[model samples]
Target: MYSTDRRERTQIQQLTSFVKAWSQIDPATAPFLGTWTAWEETKSIYPSSVKGRVCIIDGFIPNENNIGFRFGQGTVSNGRIKTDSYILIHQGNYLGGVFVYNNEPGIYEYAWPKPLKNPAELMRRVPQSDRHRNHILEQFQNAGCTASRPNRR
Candidate 1:
């Protein structure tokens, strides 16, 4: 079993490596690493479904409240990347997963889509507490995006 620190370190390394490789590619081919959000949501666990060891790195982009982008990277399920799809857990209580590129051997390039015309549109639709709101704002700030008051809402 991998320790939490080890798992986190591995994830960070993978993310760093992915970003580096992505940067090397032309802007037209590669996606921009714009103002986005991330979180360490899953814990390291061994699963019977998977033949070997595995770890889940689950989180959403733009922010936690906006959309769900479940990304997993580990040697599991007979050394396969086991996951159905990127669950869009925004619209419905249980939005069906969309089959994103599955278990590709190379590094995963998960990039955020372009910003919406009205950022507050997402915030207004989702039900968020004050703490969640502030946390999301902090994430935006960390990504170098200024968070303005939701005057449009």
Candidate 2:
């Protein structure tokens, strides 16, 4: 409605695509979702492009009730996707340390992100480990997250 290219479109397309991808989970890894879940919903309050796709390599792990920690967003263009963060927090550890990873795709290859440092120590230790991860989840919820199918238990 506005211009062909705008900021709102990017946000909508990115969020929608993210929710879709997150809904389609790996059956094998579904049971042990610690933090790497991306359950979300997206809306176009202003109008944005929904043609392209959004791909999340690694970052935050969201669960049915936990949003987990995330640092950045991914790039959505021409139905292709890429990440914007060098390191992403996939999940959290009991020690309040997050499992950090890097999804450095080279030359548009289907290269998955590797664990740069799993259980990366957090700046503030969490007396209750679940609380640390829950904090992140709440942030996304406050962002007016859209509803998606639960990926994990």
Candidate 3:
């Protein structure tokens, strides 16, 4: 099993690498993201607003429903966006990951399921209880997702 600390470190490393890559892009070539934009000094993991929008550059885990949801204005503060503005990445029956919520109009959510060793076998093991199913469905929906039924094994 992977330790949470290890996972967090890996995530941070990945984000740092992404920021480095973005730094190489000339502002003249990609004006959409802006030339002044860069990762925040305090939170090197977060992408700073280049043109009034926070860009999410982290790579998402496959299969896990990683949804991004908006909770409206006043959600952001102290140069940091509100947690509700972002979607919580779900790992199995628990919350495992997250990404910044954009400032775009209307609440947007995304859902992705965790990668499975054997998709068919995992599907077969899905609980038959309506309550369980409903709970899972609700989690994904609340995060602005409707479940991700990916075809993979």
lDDT scores in order: 0.31, 0.29, 0.27
Over 4 Å off, model 1 = 1-118, 146-153
lDDT of 2 at 92: 19
lDDT of 2 by residue, 1-153 (tens): 111222355544544454445435422221112222122311111111222222221333446653344432333332222344322222211101122346534221111111111222321233345665454445334432322433455
By lDDT, rank the candidates, best first.
1, 2, 3
Please give the lDDT score at residue 107 for candidate 3: 27
Best by TM-score: 2
Which residue pairs come into collision in candidate 2? 9-48, 9-49, 35-61, 36-61, 37-61, 37-62, 41-146, 67-137, 99-119
* Distance from true location, Cα of 102 in model 3, Å: 23
TM-score of 3: 0.20
Indicate whether candidate 2 or candidate 3 has the larger TM-score.
2
Could you arrange the candidates by TM-score from highest to lowest? 2, 1, 3
After the best TM-score superposition of candidate 3, give how far the Cα of residue 133 lies from its true spot, in angstroms.
20
- Tens digits of lDDT, candidate 1, 17-114: 44345334322211222122223222111121222322232344446454432223233222233344432221211111234465543323222222
Off by over 4 Å in 3: 1-7, 26-68, 71-153
lDDT score for residue 87 of model 3: 38
Question: Which stretch of 10 consecutive residues in model 2 shows the poorest summed lDDT?
Answer: 41-50
Candidates' RMSD to native: 17.3, 16.9, 14.7
